[model samples]
Target: MTEPQRLSRRLIEQVGCSRREAELYIEGGWVTVAGEVVDVPQFMVQDQPVALLEGAKAEAPEPVTLILHQGAQVDDRSALASITPASQAAEFDTGKRVLKGHFRRLQCLAPLQPGASGLQVFSQDWRTTRKLTVEFNKLEQEYLVEVTGTMRDGGLERLKRGITHKGVELPRVKCSWQNETHLRFALKAPEAGVFAQLCAAVGLTPLSMRRLRLGGVSMGKLPAGQWRYVTAQERF
Candidate 1:
């Protein structure tokens, strides 16, 4: 019987590839051990049939972007729980296969406010992280806010025209009633508690808030608590 050895070593011996190439194939989910895909290069194995998948490439996999529709009442940790392999939304079909390495080293962007829910973005790419963070102010976010209570005279107009806070005059935003109980707000991402404060100043109490769009991306038909990959064709 052959002694157990590192999977990368076995792949090197079997395929006659260099150490770096073996690691790339293993990390890219191209190599399988005993019919199971093993992504870790250091995985131990002995006398197991190891083979690379058909059309396997040694190139590094592209970084993935995940968009989650966080449900209301979910905390930060709980919202991230939906990122697991099984929690992927089955409705959105894509060519990208679920890989173990895809979950590592992810950076969360633009976290939702506490007790509020909507689109949550996470990415393994530095460019995406920078676009959503460093250049975040340039993007407009659309929120559907549910509120209760009557507005004071000219309160709606005040919100549309913007209000002064902490002695600073704010820029006007596109604020209008979506219906009797909901308001559509189109503006840059505001600081934490800013939305609630804005609603309060106008004699309205926010019952719930859900972001519908950020920049060019919209939370279209993404069910709450499920996540889907941002397609390559998607921008912003």
Candidate 2:
């Protein structure tokens, strides 16, 4: 049988820490094996070792990918938590957590008022959470917008040139006018929470905004309150 290794070596080998750090960590009672605490740096070990560091057991959450058909009243909070079959909607509110984690300096997109709906894409990984590709930024987001007043000349031009709301300048949006009162827009930058910002710029209160397509993937008649996974070919 192979000779059993020392506790410090076992910790360093399994936990990917420096030998000196492992010794100190083991001596300080910060190492555990098989649910039994081992505080001796020189203690002999054999077999499989489950090395642990204090407060280090929390595994990073697995990354999830999915598309969300945002409802009129839905906000970032609701979108992040709304569950689907493909993705495990995190229980923790991402908006609230991001604010606290980022020293309260994070900006949030405005929420969709009651009755507006659209597609939203999101992920939980910190590294890729803010990536536009993950949230349909690269894909064309087609919106079915209903306006109370008729779209006069320069209305489409105004949308393409971008609009300012509350003194904040919003980027120009790509759109195709469907009719006198309806238009379809494809927003390039799909930030986490910018639906309300778009509405503000358009001078419309979002009487009703429905997400028709995300990243070339359309709802295609998925009725309200239902969702489906985007297949490989479906992704644009």
Candidate 3:
């Protein structure tokens, strides 16, 4: 039979708490072992799981992905890093309750340019993160591109042909004017700020680039500066 380990050691490893935190839990009578309260930090815990007291720190909730509608003025990192009730936008807030685990580890996919917005993904599920980066080339991205200047003759055609950047070839993309100012583009992007580069090659100066969709997911009017949980019904 295996010998017992220190209670504080077991709690810190299992609960994702620090040594100090484990000691606090023990001293505060917030932890239990074998259906009994164990308040000694060095108490030997047998091969049994530790449980927190009722109304104490609860079990980690299901992992979630968040979608944020960022404005041109906001930094993408800052936007997701600090989310608060007062900062949330839209008619409703992301209904998922924030958990201690959620804030612990965050993997970001589809890094957005400073001015770019819509459909950015932040996930706690490692599978979601893996799918996005490993299979990103296979996924198509849609953008609402705004530009200034008259499109040169054959400019649209050239835009479709794509350009060579830093010894790498960017493939052709589908482009159509949304109206007079907005151009809708669909492509597989390898890097951020791709729209601006493509636009400049075709005699148009980029004003702003708003990502409308990634893969099967669409931004769908998520208010700017606001975020919501990516539903299980949604893929990608």
For model 1, the stretches where C-alpha displacement exceeds 4 angstroms are 72-78, 152-158, 163-171
> What CA RMSD would candidate 2 show?
11.9
Please give the distance, in angstroms, between residue 36's alpha carbon in candidate 3 and its true position after superposition: 28
- Give the candidate number with the greatest TM-score: 1
Candidate 2: which pairs clash? 72-116, 109-193, 117-209, 118-211
The true-structure Cα RMSD of candidate 3 reads: 9.3
- Positional deviation of 128 in candidate 1, in angstroms? 1.1
State which candidate has the highest lDDT.
1
Query: Between which residue pairs do clashes occur in model 3?
Result: none
Which stretches in model 3 have alpha-carbon errors above 4 Å? Answer: 1-60, 85-104, 161-170
Candidate 2: misplaced stretches above 4 Å? 1-68, 75-115, 122-140, 162-169, 190-205
Model 2, position 31, has a per-residue lDDT of 70
Task: Please give the range of 10 consecutive residues that has the lowest summed lDDT in model 1.
Answer: 164-173
lDDT tens per residue, model 3, 32-56: 8887776677889778778878665
How does candidate 2 score on lDDT?
0.55
Residue-by-residue lDDT tens digits, candidate 2, 1-236:
55798887877777788877776666554577787667567778778565776554322223333455566676767565554433423332232111111212222222233456765555443443454435634655667766554444575677788777779777677877677556676775445435456655655444556777655656665545543433335444
Whole-model lDDT per candidate: 0.85, 0.55, 0.74
